[model samples]
Target: MNANELTIAEARDALAGGELSAVDLTMACLTAIDAGTPLNAFVHATPEIALDQARAADARRGADAGALNGIPLGIKDLFCTRGVASQAASNILKGFKPEYESTVTSKLFEAGAVMLGKLNMDEFAMGSSNETSCYGDAVNPWKVDDRKLTPGGSSGGSAAAVAADLCLAATGTDTGGSIRQPAAFTGIVGIKPTYGRVSRWGIVAFASSLDQAGPMTKSVRDAAILLGAMAGHDPKDSTSADIPVPDFEAALTGDIRGRKIGIPREYRMEGMPAEIEALWARGREMLADAGAEIVDISLPHTKYALPAYYVIAPAEASSNLARYDGVRYGHRARLGQGDGIVDMYEKTRAEGFGKEVQRRVMIGTYVLSAGFYDAYYNRARKVRALIKRDFDEAFAAGVDAILTPATPSSAFGLGEMADADPVAMYLNDVFTVTVNLAGLPGISVPVGLDAKGLPLGLQLIGRPWDEAGLLNHAHVLERAAGFVEKPRKWW
Candidate 1:
């Protein structure tokens, strides 16, 4: 059996049925990672620890088993894992080990999931491509051959590991498009559940309001399974929804015969590559073919989403990341000190944050500063309200969901956009950011390959707490698109 290709749902069923032991699953993941290391899909792999956990899980099955008796998953480095280095893929957090695991990760543990190890990512989940990692970039698995293509970031490694079958599925965080974009590039399914659906407490916060963790997997059902394990109310995370957790697994109705899907014309912009546009059009056709009613809708605030997200997310990020300045925790950079404590904040911040992080902080500082607060930060906040209002209007108008190209283009070669103006790179997140800003659920599912043979993905957006609807829509499109490709062993 192709263990690498097995979905989390399938693997658990097999494990439950005693067809494959947790030991078998662990070995499969370790073997796949050993083979996939050339692609640099993972930052860390603790085979011994994983084996121990698998053994414990196998023993538990002999006692009382659960749905996730023995699934192995790649954890994004951003989630704080107690006693493990949760570095956020940045040099600044190099030696920072947490005393407590993030709430989402702990729940995954309780659900009986085994940890494969920490996966790589863009520094502080900042970039569109994985090139921003202090450890170096993660390569896309489906470059058709050994051709170099970026696994999208900041959750690039999470997506790549899933694509290369390095892990059954991996945890991913989407502050902007981190999860969705990378998932799109690697030809996998990744969902950014509604903001606050998954607890952010102990997650290395990039942008408090926008930062959210979800699942990256080969199939929609797998995404659903993992999301279920990661999501719940946590008193520790004030923003976490107090709403009831639904049966994400049970919500998978393979039929969406009469649903209304809206195609926002604003998403069909001038900069979108022809291949991506075709994929978007193909998605509409796929849903229509699946008996879904398709309609043309306008998210009048669409064009404003990217800018609004850039402003608000960074503003929140600056505040959230302020804690990393030298003293209390993380990599204490050698900062020139003045006589007092205030000097530490200044010197430490200057030394600790990377250039990109510094840039956002400065931008945030400038926007939130006395003179500009009303004009910049406040205006962006108002626009955020409009963006959410736009989604509410669409849903109220009877639109069950919306569709757009997950990315404007497929995976670009690493370093192609790295040295360009940082704003240039941020532009690539255009499609995925709005969902985060609106606190709505969204997903990316691979649809086809591009001219360079890199995978392309189509994104589906749904109402808040409507992950099930999003997954059903994606499954329908996945079937209609008829797209599936595996990484060749050339790497």
Candidate 2:
């Protein structure tokens, strides 16, 4: 197999055994990135930075070398990489570069991982489809005939890069299913650790309370390895948890015997596709066959999750994004002769933000407005609390993990929903937002292919800070499904 196609585990072993050089692996990925430009997976290419790090890793090779030493991975555009373009796929921050690295990137670098470049994402992470990106949609490597499919968002580029072998793996953030949905659509593995499990210090904000960074990789084991290097306590981020980081890769024994997996009845939506339903049923049987007891559970507030997420995410987004008013940094609109400060703010924002971003910001601003705060923002907050309570109740009742469909459908074509009602796109996050609302760990594992030959995935939601256990459950599902399909190289 090509070096670029190797999983993290395989690459690590080869690097350790002196069979593979860091430079070679880095070159392999860089070459793939250049050849795969049609997919627009990478918005920035950092060959100089990557090669410097790889050479340093070669010289420092020893027993004390970091876990990811010499490993090449892609960084999401949301991360603030010192001296690299750190725009979060938005025009507002075009040409902006950070002076300091984000906590996650710093940790990965400390652990010896090399960065290829920054991957594309939804503008400010405000959309479910990658179409919201200012760089144009990051096309999925998977295609049916001549139609182009979305890789999912706001981590679409991360998903596409990893799935297409443009990089060994990539960093991704999930606010409302960005990581998991893309992983599902691209037939890979993605895990959104519990909120606060990973530091938010360097990642660009979307919804402060809901956004959590994670790894997107070729396999469950790769996800585990990358998550180990990416997670730790960060004094820089106040919301970062102080818990001890475990050896996540070692926790994957692929034995989920006697674990209680809950199948939330609320997840069975009224118009759910028969293929998705069948996929969910198959997931249940797989877990049961692996000795996990499948039990019916109720998260009654599931129906309210989508509405509540819309209000709360936008409300937080509006507040967090207020910092990008062209006063401090980023794109500033050229004002007319007599324009004042307010005019610059209005014009800069009008010119910088895409339509989807503007829509969410407006919704957020409206919900948080004086007269509507109680009716929208506050009410949504209350519903969010209930959603958390529902998950907590299930876990408290001996449920080891909860299983659900990662997305309502498989990958959809680009522009398929762009011109449709925005809510139609929001419905894509129906199964995912609840996990973010409750601040719990969740993962998407590819199980089977749809009738159209596209991949489908199932989600496994775990208790807060229980990613190791959740990963083990997913590992078992991955093993049972034995899904080895890859997108034909159309790029």
Candidate 3:
């Protein structure tokens, strides 16, 4: 197998044994990233940085080397990588390079991981499909015939890069299913840690309360390894959890017997595809076969999750994104003869942000406006609290985790929903937004392929700050399903 195709665990062992050189592994990934340009996965390939990091890691390889020593990773564009372009896949932030690194990236770097480049994402992390990216759509490697599919978003590029083996793993942020949805679509593992588990210090803000960075990788084990390196407490982010970071990789014992897994009846949405239903059933059966007791549970407020998430995410986005006017860093609009500060702000934003971003910003502004604040924003907050309560009740009743479909369907073709209602696209997050709203840890594990040869995944939602347990459950499911199919080398 190619060096770049090695999983994190495998590569770590090889590097430790002196069987593989860090520079060679990084070069192999750089080669893959270069050859896989058609997929648009690495929006900004950092070959020099990756090689330098790899060399440093090789020199430090000893008792002092960290868990992620020599692993090459693609960082999501949303992360603020110091001196590198961290545009968040939006034109508004074009040429904007942060003076400092995000806590997640910093942790990974401290652990000796190499940075391959910045991956594409939905502009401001606003859309369900990666089509909203200013860097152009990050095409899915899993294509059917001549049609290109979306890798799901806004972590689509991260998913594509990992699935395509351009990198062993990538950093992904989930606002509402961005990481898990893309991972599902691409037949990989993506986990969104409990809301405060990973520090969000330098990550470009989406929905502050909802956004959490996690690892997207080839397997659950790789996810665990990468996540361990990425997660830790940081004094920089106010919402960052002060809890201790556990050894996530050691938690994958694959012994899930006696665990209570909840199958929420509310997840069986109307007009759901038969394939997705079958996949969910198979996931439940697999867990049961492995000795986990599947219990029917009720998260009755699941129906309101989508609408509530839309209101809350966008509202927070509006507040977080207000700092991006023309006067500061990034793109600035040329002034007209009489254009004042207000006019410049309007013109710069109008010229910089994409249509999907503009739409969300407007919706957010309207909902947070004085007249409608109580009617929409406050109502959504109340609903979010109720959603959390539902999960709390289930956990309190001894449920270990909740099982549901990661996405309603497999990867859809790029531009397939261009003319359709935006609500149709929003429906893609139906199964995922609830996890973010409840501030719970969630993981998407590829279970099987659909009739169309596309990959499908099942979500396992865990208790807050229980990523170790969540990963073990997912590891069990992964072993049971034996989903080894890879997307054909179309890219």
How many clashes in each candidate? 0, 0, 0
lDDT of 2: 0.95
State the lDDT of candidate 1 residue by residue for 1-491, as single tens digits. 67757888888878877888999889989988988877787787778778988998999995566557788999999998888888888877778888998998899888888999999998888888988788888988876544588888999899889988888999999988899999988889999999889999888888888889999998988888888888889999999998887878787777898899999988888867888887788888989988999999988998888888878877887787777767777666454544466776676666656677788878887888898989889999999899899999999999999988898888788878767888788888989888988999999988888887778899999988888888888888887777777767566
Candidate 3 segments whose C-alpha is farther than 4 A from its true place:
none
Candidate 3: TM-score? 0.99
lDDT: the better of candidates 1 and 2: 2
Please list all clashing residue pairs in model 2, or write none if there are none.
none
Pairwise TM-score winner, candidates 1 and 3:
3
List the global CA lDDT of all models.
0.85, 0.95, 0.94
TM match of model 2 to true structure: 0.99
TM, every model: 0.96, 0.99, 0.99
- What's the lDDT of the predicted structure labeled candidate 3? 0.94
- For model 2, state the Cα shift of residue 207 in Å: 0.8
Per-residue lDDT of candidate 3, residues 1-491 (tens digit)? 99999999999999999999999999999999989999998998889999999999999999999999999999999999999999999988999999998889999999999999999999988887899999999999998778999999999999999999999999999999999999999999999999998999999998899999999999999999988888888898899889998999899999999999999999998899999999999999999999999999999999999999999998998898899897879999999999899999999999998988888889999999999999999999999999999999999999999999999999999999988999999999999999999999999999999989999999999999999999999999999999999999966
